[model samples]
Target: MEKIAQPQSSFMKLCRKLSPKRKDSAAESQHIKNGDHDKNRHIEAVFAYMDANKDGRISPDELQKSFMTLGEQLSDEEAEAAVRLSDTDGDGMLDFEEFAQLIKGDDKCSEEEKKMELKEAFKMYIAEGEECITPRSLKMMLKKLGESRTTDDCRVMIRAFDLNDDGVLSFDEFALMMR
Candidate 1:
């Protein structure tokens, strides 16, 4: 079969940097450290999602590595907390399936995060069709973060991250801002 080429978008450029792989993945395997990463196709994508090392099955250490891979500023306390919350099996370890289920929110999150986005549009609209977080504009950004974060909160975020002083947070900066 002939392979089809996928075009890269400006947004894809950033996601490629963050995710850096094709959406389709291979099968999953049990031998994680041996470099036999993906034995299950969906699990493989999940591994790619959670596996910073591209080494299958996320260990406690791997979870931290995953955050850093995103260039996120995560403190030890916060990272450990999130890992513990998602670790599930209580083995003090998180396998690829475990990692996938958790990020997918395992029935906890109202919706599943099936697709990945590097576009500023998706980031701004993670709140999901809410008017406050309208797509494609700087005007409603803060209100989108929700009722918990007031206008003052938005101002505080802008002040902290609007590095270029452009008044608007670019997709890269916005991703970091949520951190």
Candidate 2:
């Protein structure tokens, strides 16, 4: 028992008014079904993940608040930085759904190269100096490995893990490096 997909009657009427050539140009099956709707639902799910406010859209304010709510308070400066960096649409606000789509859709890798790149990135970011991965060892490893980054002249590496700005790397933030 397969399901079916149906365009609204209004859409069907509009299609009929078009010339035969135009009518079939769209080539929509009148009985289209569940799979199409399922795709829409998946889209909604992605949107929901990014919509912290549940306001139906993802505004910069909402995004900032969501991050802030997650204990990552963005100073006004940081919020501005984030918006400038992430609001790809330049729409001045991100809809919850669109924002969700952006993150998931923003795969900066070709599938074929993903595994190799991931391995290299993990090797650089992770510290396995000791029997197990540990924060102290990880930081040291990053600082040493980052010495050769394009900005090789400066010790600007390993600074990103100090989430609290406490001049020390926390355990959880170190874990994020695995990502």
Candidate 3:
């Protein structure tokens, strides 16, 4: 039987940079030292893909193009704005270190901190002196969270966790939903 060759996807093309036969010098090893070995390799692959010209820096044009590839269609201003958020050295471009920081996120919040943060967020959906999120407010909050829910969807969601049948979500209920 003959084996058929499959076309390489863009992702596959990016990953090809990590072929086992590829060798890196001491300079490249420095970038790999910050993260788990396997994870660093993947990050490096993605970084290389974003550095479209292989120029070692991701300019706004390159970042914009990468977003366009993902169907996000970032405008020049939007792309520059994104770069500025992480452009630590202010060169108007992102080096691998800066890019990695942007992707890895800030994980400094502890569990208690997260709970307190969630409580604060939950409070935003409730009225003053109220300890629960009303059905209407819940619907509005869900929309703010990028969820497109109908009135029925909100009612069903509340019914699922409205332990007291008060047609609202108490902090305990909200915490359960968050978890």
Q: Which pairs of residues collide in model 2?
A: 4-32, 4-33, 5-31, 5-32, 5-33, 57-96, 58-94, 58-95, 58-96
Per-model lDDT: 0.43, 0.39, 0.61
> Per-residue lDDT for 136 in model 2?
53
Please, what are the lDDT tens digits per residue for candidate 2 over residues 1-179? 00000111111211211111121112444524653454345445534544666877665565456444333344555444444444667776556444434433433435434344334333433345533323454444434422222333212334554566654334454444423
For candidate 3, give the lDDT of residue 146: 40
Best by TM-score: 3
Task: Put the candidates in lDDT order, highest first.
Answer: 3, 1, 2
Superposition error at 176 for model 3 (Å): 1.5
- Using lDDT, give the best candidate's number: 3
Q: Tell me each candidate's TM-score.
A: 0.36, 0.31, 0.42
2 versus 3: better lDDT goes to? 3
Error of 2 at 8 (Å): 37
Candidate 3 per-residue lDDT over residues 51-85, each given as its tens digit: 99998999889977874654335567766766777
User: What lDDT tens digits, residue by residue, belong to model 1 across residues 1-179?
Assistant: 00100111211322333332323222423345442332244445535655556655566566555545433444566555555665777876667656555544432322112233334334543344433222233334323222245555555555576667755555556545433
- Cα deviation of 107, candidate 3, in Å: 3.6
Superposed by TM-score, candidate 3 places the C-alpha of residue 169 at a distance from the truth, in angstroms, of 1.0
**Which segments of candidate 3 are over 4 A away from where they belong?**
1-104, 145-148
